[model samples]
Target: MAKTQVEYAVEGIVTRQMIEIGKKEGIDPQWVQKRVSEGRIVVPLNINRPCSVVGIGMGLTTKINASIGTSTDIADIDAEVEKAIAAEEAGADTLMELSVGGDLNKIRKEVLAAVSLPVGNVPLYQAFCEAKQKYGDPNKLDQEMLFDLIERQCEDGMSFMAIHCGINLYTIERLEKQGYRYGGLVSKGGASMVAWMKKN
Candidate 1:
């Protein structure tokens, strides 16, 4: 597979796989080619994954994402992997492993190994969980741990990452000015940060 979408576009040859996929979606082959050429659609292909599917993003059908993982109370890697497989078999565009309790890296690797679909993750969750486990304070987590986790996930062949980079100092100040209410910042990462800040 090509390293970047641009590389895939400049090849000037439409892979048979892309044509067949376009036909299945009732889209013209040229349209698919053009979209790929423009980098509007992304087909995340992992070198280790043999089964690849074209996921149309713009002006395409709504795709489904299934999240499967374990929490601290029930950290069952086997069960989580099974669910992820089922989700893919049932036609999920992507699968995300949000394992917080168990070995996060192990769970992610096993999931990636189990499914051919694009795997996504929220690095902050793993970072916060690890920080709490190690230092008993989430705010104690610095940029190094966060960036390291992000890089590790990327190196692990994650197709995409859901990074909450928007929730920074400015966003917090805005929230504070607006008066933070119970369950205000519903995002898990945002709530975790707020709690950590309050405690620290």
Candidate 2:
């Protein structure tokens, strides 16, 4: 495994990507490195993808993440690529491909080629999507499938991902303890986790 951005920062190395990000954000490299090392900011850069890195979270200018991709019904690869460019032109700081249709690898390459911002993906979506295709149900998704998808995406140059591990039995206990019922939570990723846990 490679050292994370935080680890590199902690070792007092302001990576080239960090320097570029600092220059664009009008921040000094040392300040960016310090924040990255402290976990106050996160710069997701996959060694497989060569693009300008940027930071998110506290003490930085608000960054926009535009999610644009193809669906089963609307898998227009060209349109998706165009949308990626438009999002960057409109000042989106990041691009996440939630593509669940067509040739995903080709679409990813096209989108990455079309945009310069940091790129992210939800590997679980692909994992479950493939699982459903193979087993006729997403409920058949397993840990091996999930981890394989993650490794593949990382190798394919995904800068970041929204791993669905935050909600667990402990979270349920805490919610019950707090009597917290924030219903109608609109998180597709969270819902997927809950559904997977329920079935598994």
Candidate 3:
């Protein structure tokens, strides 16, 4: 529906943001665009927000992502924004605010304003929470609702998302062999994905 960074880069558009990312990564802007087009690098950016583009994935230095969010038990908006501030000050490459409590939209906006770095989120949290509030369980979450929530976040300037789609039936079975450890299949994102086979 929209021309993404990959589309622009593949078409030979070296954006100002790409230039900045190249400077930071000590590579040429054209190289950055090439990798972006080739799907070798990722620079999650939302045009709604003003943030320096950060290169991630293949051939870049290992980046640090500071997760700052509230659990179901706690939902303090100010505290989350403060964490974003702390993350930026401490040299976090990106920040994922996974607030499942309080006014999520307000918290996201304030947090985005609180830091110049890229802001990310786990949209499934909102979708699952909504399903729980209405349908009585996270398992009842509708896919349409999930997509709607993701669109809202994009509109609100979310630069990235932690969508763990790598887990497939084969991976699940393999992990189950090891008991899946910790939360096992009932983990954060795995529990929702009972179907579907992803690429390897």
Best by TM-score: 2
lDDT of each: 0.77, 0.84, 0.82
Pull out the clashing pairs in model 1.
none
Estimate TM-scores for all models.
0.80, 0.89, 0.86
- lDDT string, candidate 3, 145-174, tens digits: 889989899988999997857766777778
Name the runs in model 2 displaced over 4 angstroms: 173-182
Q: What is the lDDT of residue 161 in candidate 1?
A: 74
lDDT of 1 by residue, 1-200 (tens): 34554465556556665576587778876677667878876665555444457656765677788998789899999998999989989988888788888888999998998988888888888999888888897678877998988878877888777776566666677878889578777788767766655555
Quick one: best lDDT, which candidate?
A: 2
Candidate 3: where is the Cα deviation over 4 Å? 168-187, 195-200
Worst 10 residues of 2 by lDDT: 180-189
lDDT accuracy of residue 145 in candidate 3 = 84
lDDT of 1 at 174: 81
RMSD of 3: 3.7
